[model samples]
Target: MSYFKEDFKYDLTSSIVVFLVALPLCLGIALASEAPLISGLISGIIGGIIIGFFSKSSLSVSGPAAGLVVIVLDNVEALGGYEPFLVAVSLAGLLQLILGFAKAGIIGLYFPTSVIRGMLAAIGLILILKQIPHLVGFDSDAFGEMEFFQADGNNTFSAIIASLENFNNGSFVIGIICLGLLVLWESKYIKGVKALKQIPGSVLAVAIGLILNQIFISSGSALAIGKEHLVSIPILSGEGGLTAALKFPDFSAFSNYQTYVTTITLAIVASLETLLSIEAVDKLDPHKRHTPKNAELKAQGIGNFVSGLIGGLPITAVIVRSSANLDSGAKTKMSAIMHGIWLLLAVAFFPTFMNQIPLASLAAILIVVGWKLTKPSIYKKLLAVGQQQFIPFVVTILAILFTDLLIGIIIGLVVGIFYILRANYKVPYNYSTGEFKTDDGREAIKIELSEHVSFLNKARLQTTLDGLPNGCHVMIDGSRSKEIEFDAMEVIEEFRINAPERDIVVSVKDLPGGKGRMA
Candidate 1:
């Protein structure tokens, strides 16, 4: 079908873009998890191919999420080994499957819009800050952790200073060249070059880095990508094949309480992150595609399930990869599948070439990604949404920046709920008699208005109307009312227009400050 053909073309483009972006992220997340570097790539491949097959989301890309880094690291250390932790991961996947089937995916709907937006903005800022050191040729062990400070005694700001102090000239030069090429590729000057436009900035950066690395090697210079900054996949000789890389879960650890706790924690965190990313990716879709939340949860569950069985980290719908996919013109889920295929082929056939790509160049690509997510325009738009929305939004941003994602979202939710309650408390009417006579000898609802009514009373009025019986003549005793709020008056006026449909009659008593007849 024409639809299928068009989708395939889009998928190919998206797959290439996401593949380039995902390759580095998989390694970075693995480093953060304190697991074998190969674990991250395996998760990425499984997430893309396996999750893609099951996912109802056409545009979302799945991978190991940065948000789970701290937990993953803690669990790995606590469990004594990555192999034992696989047991917990399998349990986590099962729990996620339960959550999806139970319709718990709807939990994302309860998050205040302001909080979600603020979270996104804060995450963008964090990504930019964290990637800066790498972009400038620093290869510290603390690559993907979200903490402002590193375990190596370097805070975010201090890390920048450190990178500047010990910057590697060779790596820095390569990074600058790559960054310049990326910027040029994105510029309007190249807009007319359709062929060039199809090439992803990330791909261009990698290609240039590879070329520069060859040049350094040929010149016998000390400016090559070191093992510290390259992906380290274990190469098995003597009858191992792909199975040699696979690690299985140790079910013997399931007896421990810590295993259960970690499993539940991973499930909850992974599910929430996936749901949030799915929402974001759908929003970013140029075609305005809608992704099914429940289905996405199931797909992530399946991905994590397979990942655990094969000794890989749990997977989630990752925003960075999904964003890259959208920006690369991904039109369907096939792009995600193609990305997985690329990862498989790269690892299986071109590990040597992939290992040569500089981490600095990939870091540069991520820097651009971080900037796009945290643009100044985001702040301006938040302000324009008004204080009622902006206050929670700002609080969420600050909380996320100062603390972590979970705590930040909690604080924002509490603040948002407080505002909602405060708004609800402003209503002015109180019920008087429980029963009143109707023309047909039935009880008529009686509402006694306070001295004044206001916009905040909208909920109370709506509640009263919702509870009223059909064919009831509601008596609103406003004789004692001092003033009617404009919003309340508007509600009454609108009701007057459609009162017949509801079979209700509204009789307003004496006007508060005037000698007017009851209406």
Candidate 2:
């Protein structure tokens, strides 16, 4: 009971920090998914409250993952509407449940360490690149859609250039101000500000955004955050009840093969992402917490099923929120539940207040999160680990930058495996005496060299054989040997040739053509 009480306090503080971080991410990811903003919130709430309660993880935070954005958008567009997409999401959740029950959660363990690290670094890089334009108040379309090459017309780099070319001075001013305040709050100077220390930097940034917006409104400036930039929840007014905003899935689309294919894709991708996130969060936990992977899968599946039924996008254990929770000192799962409850309450009672929060402010928070994940210090640390580890790490990073996550991982795994084989190939074999003894001394020697033994193992095999006593019988053991290389087999043959002068008999057993000993 005492332990529970202690953890409760920590959970409250940590959940608040996570909530602050998650609010904008929920909206951003929903926008990226081509789903309604409220749908994202609904998922967030269910993920936090419902999944949080059932999950065995103490540090993991669940919500809409950025990795699923492309898939979600494509599915929604293909399915024609959000209702049809919900049906797919529900089916995907059911598939994940089956996977968990089958103990397929262990599949995440097979991914190479180098590849996993590369995937994370790549995600961090993407987050930074994608969020930069938003931080600068240049949201041309939805969030996370800014690619290297333009999907429609402008690429990520081009979008940045265009934003700079037609920069909104008012929005830019507010963003810069909020960014500056956040920087100041994070600085050492704020250490002495005891009361202010409790306030999250995101909260302070939001305050600045609101103040700037009010000032702009008073001055008749055209640079305020427009309706497109703010979070839009479909709040039920007096005439329309809450049921008006709520939507159910249209299962009629389930008969379509495309719908089934989309659902399977979603299920596989979502499960992989969730399992990976669960592993990463466990690794990041300060207490060295071990999350039950199967339990987590079940919880996520349940959450997604419920969320889809209530018109929400699919949910998963999101790294961004989980990292924030850990960094903010969350001690147990209760914090996640609290955050979910807060999300529901805030939307239900304070939609008007949430609408006042500026997009730039959330963008600033994400910018900080991105920088934390891809800090120069992390790179320096990776380099300090030495080339053996660094080679694969660096390769993974580059592969991820050039290709997608799954492809990048495969490349890194191949490189790591090659390195391992190369390292192992350096060992030399010693069969000069033709007397190999097992550690238990129960197994006899059966020395048979390949047709082509290289010079690489010459010295090693030579040293081993030369150190043997005179009583041990030397055997050429070339029964199955054919076309032996001059460099390696010649060395052994030369030793056999000269052994007669050293009171040693070299006997060849079963030569290639059934010939006896070679004089």
Candidate 3:
């Protein structure tokens, strides 16, 4: 109780900021997913109210994620219709719950820090590149679409070029002005002011954008923004309108095998995305608090089950909204919950007003957020960490830029694992050739095996034994090892058996199957 009250003011302010950020995203993800616009709103609402309430996460904002847009679209088409697809989503939620209870969430802990950082950096770059089209009033692609190859005919760079060719001067002006205000709002002077500090810059930028467009309209200026340049939130007029807008799940589809396949697909993808986002969100947390991964999965399961049961798209913890929440000064889960409440209220009562705000303004805000995420300092810091870390970090960023999030992450993970193997391959044991006392006081070459030797060390171990000088006395020691892999032990045994052929004296101590001197 005190937790909510202590940060109520900050949380309220941040909730409004997140609401402004999330509104277009909800619509855009819906647009990208080919799901009904109201369904997006429903997911956002459930993500906020239900997931936010149940989630242990302090800053993560769950909603219909952009990552699942393609998956949702294809499954809907494959399953014959949106109604049947809803059954898959609900079943996916059940699978997520099973996963949580099974403690599968620990998989998130294995993601290399460099890969996670790269994911965030890639998303930052995507946010900047993708939002440019919106900023210029080229609204062909949906707002939340983040893939390299968009559902629209154009790719990321091509979209920017296309937007430049057919740019809207009004949108450009609003975006530029709003961007300037956001930058200025962060200046030392504005931040130092007590009265201004409480108010969020994004709110002011959005407000000014509205006023600027209205002023242009009043004067009948050529710079007046058009409906195409503004937000397009659907208004729910009454109960009939609500019913007409939402489509329910076809429960009968549960018996279909394809439905189960789609359910498994959604559960896996959504779980991975959620786990990744949770990692990134925790990294961004100023307080450095940890979110229990299992708890988050359960919360997402509930959110998805409720969303699909009613008529919403699939849900996941989204990094963009979470980053926006952090940038907006959110202090607790209240901001997330309140954002959902605000989404519900705004759509129900003020859809017309929301529709008036220019998309350009929101684009400007996201651009700033994007820049913060992929700042130059981050690149420099990772570079200083060494190539092992930096390579995967950069690879993840580029992969995500050229591909979608999951593909990029998988690619990055592979690269990261390769580095891990390379590192392990380099030093399997300590090799020292010196005049030392063997068990009876004779000079011998000493080979101290590493604590845990795997099969990867077999080849190197064999090569070392093969290179030993003929008739040289050698000591292969494993007394300190906790576990030696069978493959590595085979190399030791083979060397011991063959030592007599080379007239070499070999001593094996504390090793499996070979613990005595070899003549």
Model 3 pairs in collision: none
**Residue 158 of model 3, lDDT score:** 94
**Over the full model, what C-alpha lDDT does candidate 2 score relative to the true structure?**
0.73
Model 1 residue 290 CA deviation (Å) reads 2.2
Cα displacement (Å) at residue 362, model 2:
1.1
Over 1-519, each residue of candidate 3 has an lDDT whose tens digit, in order, gives: 787668988889888989999999999999999889999999999999999999999999999998999899899988989999999999899899999999999999999999999999999999999999899888889999999997657799999999999999999999999999999998999999999977899999999999999999999999999998899989888999888998999988977889999999999999999999999999999999999999999999999999999999999999999999999998999899999999999888999999999999999999999999999999999999899999999999999999999999999999999898887777888989884666654458988888899998877788888998886789888888889998988888778888889988887777776676565
Kindly list the per-residue Cα lDDT of model 1 for residues 1-519, writing each as its tens digit.
986766777778679878877887887788877787778888999988999999989888898887788888899888878888998888888888888898889887777777777777777788778777777678775455676656677677788888889777667888888888877877997767998786777778888887887798789898765666655545544356566666788888878788988998999999888887777776667777878777777778888888999878889888778877876678889899989999988877788767777777877777777777778988888789788788998898788777777778789888888777666654566675546666666456777777777777777786676777877777777777777877777776666556668877766666443233333
**lDDT minimum window of 10 residues, candidate 1:** 510-519
Q: Name every residue pair that clashes in candidate 1.
A: none
- Order of all candidates by TM-score, from best down to worst? 3, 1, 2
Q: Which numbered prediction scores highest in TM-score against the true structure?
A: 3
Off by over 4 Å in 1: 1-4, 241-245, 426-519
**Candidate 3 at 391: error in angstroms?**
1.0
Best by lDDT: 3
| Alpha-carbon TM-score of each model against the true structure | 0.81, 0.78, 0.95
lDDT of each: 0.78, 0.73, 0.92
lDDT of 3: 0.92
